[model samples]
Target: MENKQKKIVLTGGGSAGHVTPNLALVPELLQHGIDVHYIGTDDGIEKTLVHDIPFHAISAGKMRRYASVKNITDIFKIFKGTKESKRILKGLKPDLVFAKGGFVSVPVVWAASKLKIPVILHESDYTPGLANRLCIKKAQKICLSFDTADARSERSILTGSPIRKDILDGDRAAGLASLSFSGDKPVLLIMGGSLGAQAINDAVDAALDTLTQRYDIVHLRGKGKLNPGLEGSDSYRQYEYMEDGLPDVFAAADIALSRSGANAIFEFLALKLPALLVPLPLSASRGDQILNAGYFEKRGYAHVLEQENLNALALVQALDALWEQKDEMVSVMGNSKEADGTSNVLNVIFENIGVQ
Candidate 1:
């Protein structure tokens, strides 16, 4: 008798960080002949990023850490979303579900639990987010991107974050050509993530002349954050974002200055890119990025610059220090354990699905 085809339902959204891991799994799952599907909020980033895959959008409510006027209405939204998710799960009858941590994943995990569909949740932070904490009991396996994560459950497994394969194979020549850089100087890539960082942008922009004198700068300023005035500056290029060209840009970079988001930093580690990380301060975030940065610094993988103390002068000093130590940083990254979790994660999924 022939074996039945395996089907998987992946759920995560709100930010690109929550969705990219699922995207990393898609190509591998397809190669294994497994049918892949995504469940996300209708308006979330996941819906936009998970193109070419069969995506199912269901209503989801944000689980706020602070009190908000919408909390009352969001309670009803969660209940409604759970109902919708359950209905969708019943129709799809998938063999398993994989959830990356995000508010949009809560309803899908709950529905999968009630239906007895096995779930594997991936937590990318040192601490579990509110969404993942709620879904912990429902998940059959909890894959962690950070070993420091306090899942405490026997199901938790430390599997570093999954990274796209193409990112590791970027073409330096192509990257230089794409940016119209002469390759006369080292490239310093600045990325503030998909939403951009106003503080970093301001500081970098203010110190552009100083930075441009030392290196060619490729700045991903996030969506709508490009400065029109800097368009024709020598040894400087600014882009809102890059989809297909991101790999090439990475290849061309000698060093990086970035926000310390877990997924992004892990990709830097995997690619052996020496970076100076400026974590979002505790006032703005849950301090997860601070912890992530600290971890990398402790491991000698990257240098950290606190956002509160960062200015144009401080940014230049930090980048200069990082550049001076770039060789050591690259060596440390190379000596560390492999950072790509794609295969390890896929093995877990296959084990749970009874595939060898």
Candidate 2:
């Protein structure tokens, strides 16, 4: 709308599970000559992921689903976060605010709404979180990761989730080198969401000797401590994160063991990698994982194992079942629908922002 590059603000964090997807949109917006600013809390994962980006820090206090005395303190924190967000908006005067909903995004979205700035939100979960639900009315558009989440909002459109462009374009040879493994054996990729699944990690820890016997393993340790329990064993590698290069890891893998987060789930499908899913328990407040895992299970694209029922034995058994039916699994993976979500999403944002 002006000669200067349009300033845009993005807010979301509190966990890598949310932040990583938000980060994926940065380069795209930058390529379009837009200046991006972030608003997030100091207390959450935003600090680690968006640390390099220009950001306004806010005190978005903790919000617990269950009743707690701490709620009183957090309410005050949320209000403080809103004030900080208002100041940032007033100073930046962004053309739009793109929010990936979480505790951190609440303030920025609220401020943008009050200031009458166009706001767009993305929900990576099938069941939207409370912060996102609150922003629904004020949000000019809602980008969703799955079809199931559509019922919650009239403005919702399925955009999958933004992932690194290279990941969406990976080749097999690049995939093999990415994990530092030879192309001889079938590669297996394991990820326990963003923070790492300690329970899944423990189960993998217990079955390492058994698993490496058949598959080359690339275990993403998430935020969990890395002990290198499988170092002495051949064909096993572990890391606390995968920011450096991950398309290679996914491209090399014949199968993957992953927690059911929207980013991971859709990326796996985009890569057409068969998977065994472990949904974070219902008590986790985001019942979306269950819905996500179930949707794939219904389509035979992946398998789901609830946390309570997951153990080393069960995990191995599921692995074996998948291996035994490799042909069927591959066929299912091959049939997966192609997802060209980012371009579609950008169109929606452009139309609303009055971009030519």
Candidate 3:
């Protein structure tokens, strides 16, 4: 008799970063004939981001750093989410659970552990997030993006972050044409991330005149952050967010100014895009981006401009410095052994599932 088709469930959500790596793995998984499904909250960004697969929605309690009234109620929600996960997993009977850390992944990973199903967790930061930290003991293996001291355990594998194939297939001409750019000057891609960076947006507002003198700018100002005053500028274009043309934008960019999220920086490395990183301040985040930027900066893969020193003048000066070192940064990126981890992650998944 023929064996049943191998099945897998990917779990992650809360932000675009959490869902992106899982998306990168989908094409390859389908090509290999592995059945793929997704588990996330019913209303998360993940639900809208994921398509063409059996997506099972489950309750997920958000992870928080501070005590709040929601924390008390979320305990019950988490318990309910675990129950929902167990029911879904039993029905799917997946051979493995592959997860990129996010709040939604915690309940699912916990449920998978309880079911005696093997789980593989991918940590896309210099330091593990709380979700991954809680699931570490339950996970069979932990995949890492950085070769940090804390991730030196036997079960940890430094396979790097998986990058979407389309992100690496950007066409400069297409990007320029789509934006109505003349390509007379280098393109500057400024991304403040999905929710938008007010500081970045404000800095650009102050520096636009100076910046546009030498570079055409593409600004992904996050949702609801677009400035109508700057809409008429010929050398500048702004979008709330992009999907269809994002690869082209990346392709056309001469230098990237972005938040140093693990997913972002790794993709930049893969494309050999020179970057000027502005990590989220520690007061606003867990300091993961700071460490992530530090790692790349130390290796000459990118330059870091701290959020504390961020201003219109500082932004311009730092970008000028990044432009000066751009060629060297590209050379360093080309020589670096770190790369997209799609194949490595797939190999690990197959190895654990007792398949090729």
Strongest candidate by TM-score: 3
Model 1 Cα displacement at 119 (Å)?
Answer: 0.9
Question: Between which residue pairs do clashes occur in model 2?
Answer: 175-248
Better of 1 and 3 by lDDT: 3
lDDT of 3 by residue, 210-313 (tens): 99998999999999999998978889999999978899989999999999998889999999999999999999998999999999999899999988899999
> Candidate 1: which pairs clash?
none
User: Model 2 segments beyond 4 Å from truth?
Assistant: 1-4, 51-53, 149-153, 169-171, 174-180, 222-229, 324-338
The estimated TM-scores of all candidates read 0.95, 0.88, 0.96
54, model 3: CA deviation in Å? 0.5
**For residues 1-356, what per-residue lDDT tens digits would candidate 2 score against the true structure?**
65766878888987776687777777877888778898887767787678546977888876787899998898998888888899989999999999987888888888899999999998887778888887888898898877663734577777777765778666778767766678788888999876788888988888877888888898888775687545765588889988766876777788889889888887877777788999888787457888888987887778888889888889899988866766686687576542555665676677776666
Candidate 1, residues 136-216: lDDT per residue as tens digits? 999989998776635445888878788888888899999999989999999999999888898899999999989999999
Local error of candidate 1 at 22, Å? 0.4
Name model 3 segments beyond 4 Å from true. Answer: none
Q: Which candidate would rank higher by TM-score, 1 or 3?
A: 3
Backbone clashes for every candidate come to: 0, 1, 0
Overall lDDT per candidate, in order of appearance: 0.90, 0.80, 0.91
